[model samples]
Target: MTRNTLEQEYDIVVIGGGTAGPMAAIKAKERNRDLRVLLVDKANVKRSGAISMGMDGLNNA
Candidate 1:
């Protein structure tokens, strides 16, 4: 890694692995089966966003 490394390569790099990122990655993958997809964010992406803050905006909404 380098201090100036914004990025070097990637077919697609999505920030904020929320509902959109995952869906985008999935769609991009479907569009090009050979593409390399990356989902990244400062927050814990493994856990769904918004809902993690004790806000059930999507929970049965």
Candidate 2:
């Protein structure tokens, strides 16, 4: 396997892909389009969260 390194600079770094994390990142960008915002999550943001996994299934079921 090959390893890669990434270097980035951001004015705002929001951790966690859970519920509020994405919202916060969106709001920050809305407020300042020029600002650098980074959103980091342990798992895939789209499929990893209580709302996506639990609530979605519960509602559909």
Candidate 3:
């Protein structure tokens, strides 16, 4: 097996790509366009988390 190394720097790092995670990252970047915002999630960002699992039901209610 081979090992791969990755390194990056960011002003803000948001854990989770859930409902709030993405919004928070967007807001941070809006506040400071120069900021390097990083959003990390264990699962696929697009179709994962509460939003994917029908959290919008709560909002609609």
Best by lDDT: 3
List candidate 3 segments past 4 Å from native.
53-61
Candidate 2 ranges with C-alpha deviation above 4 Å? 1-4, 53-61
What candidate 1 gets wrong by more than 4 Å, as runs, is: 1-8, 51-61
lDDT of 1 at 43: 65
lDDT of 2 by residue, 30-49 (tens): 99999998877677644775
Which candidate model has the greater lDDT, 1 or 3? 3
Query: Which candidate, 2 or 3, would have the higher lDDT against the true structure?
Result: 3
Report the C-alpha lDDT of model 1 over 1-61, residue by residue, as the tens digit.
Answer: 6576475678899776545656677788889999987767566633566444553342212
- lDDT (C-alpha, whole model) for all candidates: 0.62, 0.71, 0.72
lDDT of 3 by residue, 1-61 (tens): 9999999899999887677877788788789999998877777644566674665442222
**Prediction RMSDs, each to the true structure:** 6.5, 5.7, 5.3
Tell me model 3's lDDT, rounded to 2 decimals. 0.72
Task: Name every residue pair that clashes in candidate 2.
Answer: none
Q: What is the TM-score of each candidate against the true structure?
A: 0.57, 0.70, 0.73
Ranking by lDDT: 3, 2, 1
Candidate 1: lDDT over CA atoms? Answer: 0.62
Looking at candidate 1, the ten consecutive residues that score lowest on lDDT are 52-61
TM-score of the candidate numbered 1?
0.57
Q: Which one is best on TM-score? A: 3
